[model samples]
Target: MQSTASTPELYLAELPEERQHIMTALRDVIRENLPAGFEEVMSYGMLGYAVPHTLYPAGYHCDPKQPLPFMSIASQKRHIAVYHMGMYADEKLLDWFKEEYSKHSNTKLDMGKSCIRFKKPEQVPLALIGELASKMTPQEWVQVYESQIKR
Candidate 1:
């Protein structure tokens, strides 16, 4: 479910107690591993990592006032989700993630174009997620967004 929380801390606080640790861990992993230039912010009511306007003043094509989103994490009704725009814009990244996920997780990967869903918190592979977070730099993401996804 989309959260109305204004800050990352508030977003974490709003999560159910059982989900707090995993979500916080996911946030920490992303923060520690994401390449420099991506700022952590609350976007679209979720915890978001984005290329700030200072870096790319064009901002998001869909909403210029908002930063260009690179990744986001949210607690859905039935699952916790990680959305990585790199996987959606780059097929090789998607293929690599699918392959690596098989190696790291015993459970089948549940995913959409950009959203990776984990129904069980124990099944979340933190290290793999960290590696994925580190895979794309903000400049690279902005380039990809301009070339591939932006209109």
Candidate 2:
């Protein structure tokens, strides 16, 4: 996977037409709902939104130079994934969302700590996804992280 650590927008501009279409749509939807301080970024070879710097000086565990992200979108070899960091990392929240997810879709999506994989964008419920994205803000996220770190 190529890294677009610098010039993320330019990088996205160069993606394959099909991938670009999906990324653009996902990026726009995510951008529209993001909380303050979050900016567009290219991380892990995909388009992701993150806190610019105010809250997290060192982003995720893997990349410490940027602000840690709350969510992200990636184009995989076979599918795209929208990552909801808090949901998967937070047991209570994940369980709550699992119940909620089941109510609307019978399909059981594959999940990793915070990543939810979807074969296509249509499979994701935009409204519910928006709610999930809006559930926590950078400030609230930092507070949660700090408290957890203290443990």
Candidate 3:
């Protein structure tokens, strides 16, 4: 569900108490392992990590006014989701994640192009998510976005 909350803190606070804990843990892991240069912000109603305009004035090709998004975590209606733009843009990265997922959790990987869905909060692999967050720097993401995904 799209949240109307104005800030990440508010967004977390708005979730149900049980969800608040899961989202908070996931957010913390992403924040701790994410490379330098990514700014945490409220993007598309979720907790987003992006390359600020100062770092990439070109911004997002889809919306220049918005910072270039790198990753995001949200509590969706039926699951908690982690979205990594890098995984979508880089086939190697996607393959690596798919392989590593099996080593991290007993549950099958539930994923889409970029979104990793966890139907049960307990099944979420915080360490794996943290490693994924660290896999790309903002500069690297900008490069990938431009060369591969941007129109």
Per-candidate RMSD, Å: 1.0, 2.5, 1.0
Candidate that would win on lDDT: 1
TM per candidate: 0.97, 0.81, 0.97
Instruction: Compute the lDDT for candidate 1.
Output: 0.95
Number of clashing pairs per prediction, in order: 0, 2, 0
Candidate 1 segments exceeding 4 Å error:
none
Which pairs, if any, clash in model 2? Answer: 59-67, 59-68
Better of 1 and 2 by lDDT: 1
- Taken over the whole model, the C-alpha lDDT of each candidate is 0.95, 0.71, 0.93
In candidate 2, residue 95 scores what lDDT? 87
In model 1, the clashing pairs are none
Return the TM-score for candidate 3, rounded to 2 decimals.
0.97
Better of 1 and 3 by lDDT: 1
List the candidate 3 regions with Cα displacement exceeding 4 Å.
149-151
